[model samples]
Target chain A: MKTKKHENHTYIIESEDMERKNEMLLQYIKEKVNQLLQIMGTKPLRDEELNDESLIAIDPIGIIAESFEQVLDHLKESNRQLQLARDYLQAVFDTAGVGISIIDRDLKIIKCNEKQKELLVNGVSQIEGRHCYEVYCGIDSPPLICPAIETLEMERAVFLKEVTKKGKVFQIVTSPLRDRSGSISGVIEVSMDITEKKRALEAMCQSEKLAAVGQLAAGIAHELNNPLGNILGYAKLLLMEQDTTEFQKNRLEVIIEQAKRGSSIIKGLLEFSHQKMPVFERISLNACIELALRSLSDEIRSNNIEILTGLGTVPYVMADPKQMEQVIYNILLNAIQALEGKGGIVEIKSEALNGSVEVTIKDNGPGIPKEHLSRIFEPFFTTKPVGKGTGLGLSICAEILKKHSSNICVESEVGKGTKFSFRIMGGVTGNV
Target chain B: MADKSGINLDVINLDIRGQICPACLLISLKEINKHKGLLRDGEANLIVKTDHRDATRTIPDAAIAMGYAVFVEKKKGYYEITVGRKDEDQKA
Candidate 1:
């Protein structure tokens, strides 16, 4: 009986211990579930709604796990869209027509596109992470017109209307790239090549100036021509008298000679101002060239200049033969004068091409200067001494060719030579 | 039982009109757990109509987290939150 009593008490104590452990484990589970609910941004779990047994049965952890999976799905979708946007922007940045470059506040180049490389960067040169000024402007330091500095200093967009770099004109626009907090971190530079546009504008201005000068020249020439002719006529009439002294005869001859020179100058001005429209006819360009050379043959021979001709079998071009010969004469005379009596080669080549006859006149003499190339066809723009030339030679040639539906071109180097080429229509189809 | 619609639409409605935040959340979760399989398979919809204002916010959030579509409707004096799939509103 005593052993039975001891065993029963021991069994009761073990049973109580087991109940306490179970109660503690249930409390721990409740606390953990409540913590998870709080993290889900919700109110804590109520003990009344979920007793220890019900909480375990519902498996709140599993519910929260599935909730997180949905959240993950949404996040992944957002990331995918963001990546697509980034790729689209990158494509636009690369294929833009104008040069584009990205630079940091320190002026270090971050990215440069294909046009930027073509416009500013040289082949096989490293530019990434280097100073932008060094690569773009080819200088050790930033230039006074550096748009990067302007953008950083102004903290806004900067547009430089005209910038000359690498001997080409550009219009530069720079915009600041700011971070989320609105502080500038870098800059985006856009450069457009406007070199051709600038040259075209200059040519337009030059033509306007030429038109104004031509009008003034015509007015002066008109006012002086009548007086000059009368002076020459009276002086010649007095020279014919028999009672004149030798001294008076000498003075009359001088007056007549000077007046004739003045009249010739006036005639040139009138011809330039009122350039006649061509009376088109089927004329041989070779015949025009032959006549011009024949007229200047004495000068050509005296200067010891060699005439090299490669006249191909070309058809007759529709032009005014008189004006065409005049054009050839002016160009050849200029070439002879350019040789300065030092014997040189003048190549005359003609060919039939694309239903047009193209002619080239080249001289192996001291070429025109680099700066005077564009102004060579302008009236009265002369490099010759004041009394030596009238300065209307090339300009008048240009005018005559214009009437013939063609233009003149001259290419010159300082020490080498000059080449001039122009084309006139020749095929039967061109006649219509 | 067939309603006036004459289709056997399974709708379980829990009316906790006087409840507040946490109690509303716990009761909604218990009901959702009880019918998780039915709700996913579009077989049943769980409708919890409560007067507690916070329940509208909390209940819908928790249901959506559990991968169930939820719609909340405000009636005369109480907010009703429905948690299920397609045709859940028509069934309610």
Candidate 2:
């Protein structure tokens, strides 16, 4: 208001005020625009860039608003891509075959896949946030050997070949889950169900043991035969001398009888070590069973026991008739002897399955003890009293089945019953 | 659209070589606005060749704020700032 324009220039002073006021408004506009740009994260505008007349026409707010829309759009797109990646990882985690679980530092289950839940808990509902040991072994606290604990302590991966829980076997691998700074934060555990593999391994070990034992028994029998033959020949010659006294004759008779018993036992051992020659001929296992039952009819009747037979329509198995009949008779006689005093019932079933004939004989007599089940097929392993069994009955049965490229399995529960089952091929036996 | 190499592209060249900060930023923004549709659709690239080193920073900052993919390259006598849509794998 007080300027040189007012010095003897009062007439033009109002226009000067207007001019000054216009400059002030332009400056305000520039300030406001630059402020907007600063908020939008960009550099301030300069004076020479745009004339005051065209400043508002540029629509800087609209330009920045549109640009912000792009920025927001980019952020949303980034979020969408991240969600896609997360979903892909979740799908992979859920679909993996191995049981997978993530546990926190305190041994709490942070996450568990369906496979893991199925394996450990048999798919119990809502296991997350629970203690890992509680879910895995159904116990309150961690067991003596825990993979997650070891992984966290060692800060590395640990693999356990076989771990038994709930009577089933598992192979577990645990790795440390580390934080960004490479410090162990938790554990990621993976488990594979190896119960069947463990069973197969055990069966293989049993087979190898039996094979070695058979070889040893064969060698022993071969060595004992010559000496036993000499003993029997000399005993017979002394008895035939005709000058021996009654006491000497009686002693020699006892010796001959005992030698014969020893020879019979040795014969059984040799048969168990190597099965008798089985002529591979087409034979009806059903007929073999019937024949064996008829021969054991008197014994079965005298024992006051009932015999049940369920013979299905089966193909002729490629097995020798005599050997197959002997197997059936031996297995049946064992069952009858087991049920002699108990007068229990015996059920026999036969069926065709998987290009082979299967036979199962179940007895209601006292079941074989658990301790003796595995050794029952071993030669000279019997619970029968002395002079009753040579312990080679079941062993010979096992050897015969082995020669036929099969095996006889026995399932027993003490005081309940015992079941013996085996399979024989009906067509040409191509492979063992 | 097709250049000498027969690739589908329309290059909008902005030579802001002796200018510094605010002016460099304003000029790059104007070019981006002028070809907003094509650049956003990945059909055009606003290639700014600048001699001032500050333009390399200011121009790319503004261009990226508008959701344009930016790549800064140092040439013999100038810096080339390429801005476009992130529609393809590209490097300056």
Candidate 3:
């Protein structure tokens, strides 16, 4: 038994009575209501009745039950629509051609598209949560001018003109990602592969430089010719005088030889400057190539470079024989030099294709770097050390090929090799 | 233009601006030859100013070849060449 005292009154309660009172008389009432609910078997309790304690407390009888049911139904429909929108956005993200990535403020890649995975990370799985600099640049730290870093640091959009990574060029744009509070959270990077565009820009710049150099060379060569000739003639006259000592005669002979050499260089400059037009004639390219190869037979033999010539059915083209020979000779010399004296294979293949004669020169040697490949055809641009290269050979070849209505293009992969290819249109008679 | 430098001597001023190469050299030579009498007596000097780069080399070389004492001074965008006969003392 238990006794509880109140103001001016006392009540006695037995333990059995207390237990009966705590047994929840409301539960019996709930059972009676459930029996009535069983008549409507398809109706489930509203979510507010089960999980929302606050709503249950505010309205014990569920006076707002209908309203809560309608609200829950509306929320369900809105969620379905939102899920559909999310799926549509996901499809667009996956199907985009350009590489797109979202990076967190800590420079970790949070999300990337299919193109980003394929082109940037070399199709590596599990790129998410990896550091962006490590995946894109292969460096442990971000480069000095990384667009993502700049966007995050400056809290603005940043654009990079051209960035070369893994031997491919890309135009990158990055913008800051902001949270609902209007604070930057991360950066979104969009990159487009622009290798072909970069190559075109390089070619334009190279041709401009070549033109300026040619104009200057032509002016100087013309002025130098008269002085060089006067020097040569005077030296010859002095050499012809019999009343001269042996020492004096030797000096005059040396002067004459040097002046003659200068004259030859001036002649080459004139040709390079396009002052002399090539006299075009229908010629067999195979024969011209053979003649040029013959001229370098000794050098090739000494260097032990294996020459593989694959001459297919080739058509005759309208070309200047001497200039064409020079072109072949220059490209062959370049191929030999690329071998670096360690001895490698030089492949020369000529074939007729697409109404033109195509020539390809491939070498298994140290390949050119991506940075230098663009400027290789520009005059005075060379990778060789000082005194080892004149830097005019390829420019001259390009000039000659341009005159023949053809163009030279190179494909090189670092540490693999280089391939130079050109096409020259055939004459009026296809088989001439 | 001649001035008295505490001595009665003559100076000839020749200007060949906007002239190119050998023309500037040739004109400077003509002026030097015209004052040859004063030059021989060591009574005058020839000063020629030209804005041609080639003339800087050609005029000096031609003047030196013709047995004249030449001095070249480069001014802003131009050259001043002074020519005189070898002094008797210098010849000795």
Candidate 4:
């Protein structure tokens, strides 16, 4: 009888321990649910009260255990769904070319994809948790025209806005984020680096303006041609007169020279305005360059610039010979001008590589500045002071080559020299 | 047998498909206009192929916006819309 009583006592203690464990688990679950509600930005649920009908005369242990089990199951299922959604979203973000970022209501970057990180850090570090303005716009606080804040307040998507930061332009769009309860939660910003696009647009605008100017120049040149011919004809007539004095002859000669200069200027303007379409024919590029050099013999000799020709045997290229000659002439003239009355070596080399003919014209003159390198092919962009350079030389050469589906690339180092390489499509001679 | 009251007119046929957006719908209309003279003369038809179902439902609305009389029909996997002169539809 004594041992039986001890067994009962032991059973009671063990049962009490199990009940306490159950209560502790319920408390833990309740705390976790509260935490989850806080994360989801929702109100927490109230615990069972003594006067509550749902809990009236109910066994607290059973109720707590069953509720905790249900909560656990729900959390597990929700966590699985959340993980799947996160994976799908991450996949979309990674594959999208445009940069994307999510900012909380506080303007702190809550999430950012690879492209966003690439644009903000230039392929460097992670940008998560950083303030959007500080990291991207380099501002301590958000700007007055903050798209993210506006999107959140208006609860609507905004169109792309062009913004410049750190000398680079970006096109950014923002959309409001809504929670399950249809409340605005945050903002999603999509940005694209539109600097190159903007530059291309500006270039096209400039090209259109140049085209208009070319038309005007053509008209002016046509009108000036007739007067120039008259002046030249009269000057020659005066020079041939038998009764003309030495002073008169000298004056006539000066008039003739000025008229010739004006004629040459008109010719250049006509060439710029009337760019003939390239008529491609099979021709040896080496022969063309050699002939161009021969044509420039007088100018090259007067400048005392040494001309070195490394004319490698190249495959015949289908190109307009006259246009190619003009291209070479412009390059050689530019090289001579860069020397600025000083003598330097101009090397011309040719090679056939990878189904293309590469012709390089290198000059040992004061090289172009780094900033001016890209703008060299832009119309009217010249380093030479006004009237000294029309700046159409390189631009016209580029256009001519571009018509032949060819390209010209320039590489220069300050104080060193400049090398211009022209690549043309080679004729397929049945040999790869 | 004094007079025949009912008169039938020929129906114009036009097919447009592969419409993914409003822009595509507009482009299809522009393409149809290439045969506008023939349609006016009641000689030729406009045919297009599209793969978007939502755009099919929206075609009538688009036709209304352009002040066109259109008849829409649904086949197994496509929608065909006919747009032409209103008086020429009496033969259908």
Worst 10 residues of 4 chain B by lDDT: B1-10
Against the true structure, what is each candidate's TM-score? 0.65, 0.61, 0.57, 0.59
Candidate 3 chain A, run of 10 with poorest lDDT: A36-45
Quote the positional error of residue A96 for candidate 3 in Å. Answer: 5.0
TM-score of chain B of each: 0.81, 0.83, 0.79, 0.57
Worst 10 residues of 1 chain A by lDDT: A1-10
DockQ of each: 0.19, 0.26, 0.00, 0.01
Fnat per candidate: 0.28, 0.33, 0.00, 0.00
Q: Which is superior by lDDT, 1 or 3?
A: 1
Across A1-432, the per-residue lDDT of candidate 1 in tens digits comes to 122346888777777787898889888878877887776668777778668766766677666665555546545765897899989988998889999999999999999988889888876378889999889877888888677999999998999999888878999999999999999999999999999999999888867876886797778999998899899999999999999999999999989988987877787778777777888888888888889999999999999999998888788788988888888888988988888899999988888888888888999899999889878888888887775567788888998887777899888988899998888889544322
* Higher-ranked by DockQ: 3 or 4: 4
Query: What order do you get sorting by lDDT, best first?
Result: 1, 2, 3, 4
lDDT of 4: 0.72
Kindly report which residue stretches of model 1 are placed more than 4 angstroms away from their true locations once superposed: A1-70, A87-97, A113-131, A138-145, A153-156, A164-168, A210-220, A231-265, A297-313, A340-345, A351-356, A387-391, A428-432, B1-92
Candidate 2, CAPRI quality class derived from DockQ:
acceptable
Q: Candidate 1: DockQ? A: 0.19
lDDT of 3 by residue, A1-432 (tens): 556656233443454566677555545544433342332221223343323342234332232233234335545766898999999988998999899999999999999998887778875678889999988878898888788888988899999888878888998999999999999999999989999887888778877887887898888989999999999999989988889889999899889988987887677677778735678988888888899899999879988899999988788888889988888888898989888789999999899988788889999999999979868887877887764566788889888888887889999998888999888888547463
Full ranking by DockQ: 2, 1, 4, 3
Q: For residues A96-175, could you state the per-residue lDDT of candidate 2 as single tens digits?
A: 98899999999999999988877888556878999998888888888887889989887889999988776668999999
